[model samples]
Target: MLVVKHLSGEYEQRDPRTKAYATKVKDASLSFETFELSQIGRENNGRADALSRIASAETQSLTGSIYLTEAKMPSIEKRECLEIHQGTDWMTPLKNYLEKGILPMDRREALKIKYRASTYTIINGRMYRRSVSQPLLRCLNTEEQHQALEAVHEGICGEHLAGRSLAFKILRQGFFWPTLKADASEYAKKCVQCQLFATVPRQPPEEMTSVLSPISFAMWVVDIVGILPTSMKQAKYCIIAIDYMTKWVEARPLSAITEEAAKKLFLEHIIL
Candidate 1:
């Protein structure tokens, strides 16, 4: 048997027999955004645009290992793009100082070498690194860098793509970060959708637990449950007792539960 309560704005009382009837309840729902949907859409669009920009390069089809993004192509020349980053993440201050022409001790030492000196240089409030054929596009900030990776890996233009492909696409589009490949791989592995659809593991991590109760009636458990439909006798709750060793069970219904009722049940069912 089931009890139906009217949830509609107006308070209602119905006869006991009307338990099966449905009552309209007032709408009680709250709404807020957990993440900015607009921002996600923008990221997807950016991914699509980047993919489109590299569509020609993708057609060359030499090997999956090769990147064909416009940013990574050999034909592209070195350039600098300066932008401010706003975040408390670790990379913030380092990038800030580099863009401001302040090199850390390690970079200063490395820059002293004639060959390595041209590797890192500042232009127009931005840090630029000259690679083999093109300058690495210093990522604007961590969020934008993450967004770029996510866009390439799982955004609209992405078909839930793999880490390698995602990283390649981002690189081709001219973005550079410290752990580009590693970050892309980790992100792909952690994608909730990918995990949801992934194949199940064949092996269990641990062995199953062995049962400890060896004899019947060796252990017992008891509990009260329910705001059940009130019967003609006004019983709307039940007290249940179970013997762990024997799997024996007993129950009694009640309209109300009290210390006296519980004591009575315990004494009658277990103590006796």
Candidate 2:
């Protein structure tokens, strides 16, 4: 019996002696190699599908649309700092002190706010504080002012800069607060990405203080030095202890470096 399998536009058969044409043979069971042909067809289909998927992925990557997501918006151009008028919740207290001449009953409290009369002024129905050269530091209750300052300093416009730079950027954007420098410094220090990539300073920020060991054995540095030429006792490793101020030195040799040997040396020579 013989059968034909067409693959890649070519006829295929296992036995070369088998005839090429199909014909009915009497009293003989005919079987086609359909299973092998099907297997080969499946393999070709799988390869084709994989190639198609790879092509689709490459096309999407080039077009930058591999997955659907929120449409990105363009960044706004840097603009002049905008000022907020009074009527904000944070400004209520200062507004009251300026418009009504109201003072708290406590003498200390009254004295504390006395500078407000001179420092603060009403402009276009809003309360503002006077400052030299820089924009007026608007008095806001606490949270809102911090939020506004942070939005400019560390939000979308921010590039996770250093403390001084962050504060200066905030100031240039016309926002002022009492602890602007400290706040910016703290925020930048806590930024996870900034900390991971922060550059170490060339010089120490503060002068280093010398450590003084008042007496011998007062301050000791201990380390393990090892793998020397083995002697008669088979002691090839050594533990060294040095005094910081007095320049005192002590060493113990061991055949094999072990915790028990090191502890025994410390207790016998150094401790006792």
Pairs with steric clashes in candidate 2: 90-141
For lDDT, the strongest prediction is: 2
The CA root-mean-square deviation of candidate 2, after full C-alpha superposition on the true structure, stands at 21.7
lDDT of the structure predicted as candidate 2: 0.67
- lDDT of candidate 1? 0.65
Q: Model 1 segments beyond 4 Å from truth?
A: 1-117, 198-272
Residues 1-272 of candidate 1 have per-residue lDDT tens digits of 12222423133546533322332111112243342211235545786666666656646655676466444633223357887765375344455455554554676543544343345555676655558887576654677778887777777767776688778878888777768888888898989988888666878799877555777767778799999999999999999988877778889998898888888887887778
Q: Candidate 2's residue-wise lDDT over 1-272, tens digit each?
A: 11324332245545433332222221122354332323335545786666557644645455443444343542232346988865445355556778887777888867777765677778878666687776775544568566865676568866778889888877776666667789778877788878787787779889999988888788988888879999899999999989998888899888987889878977999899
Worst 10 residues of 1 by lDDT: 20-29
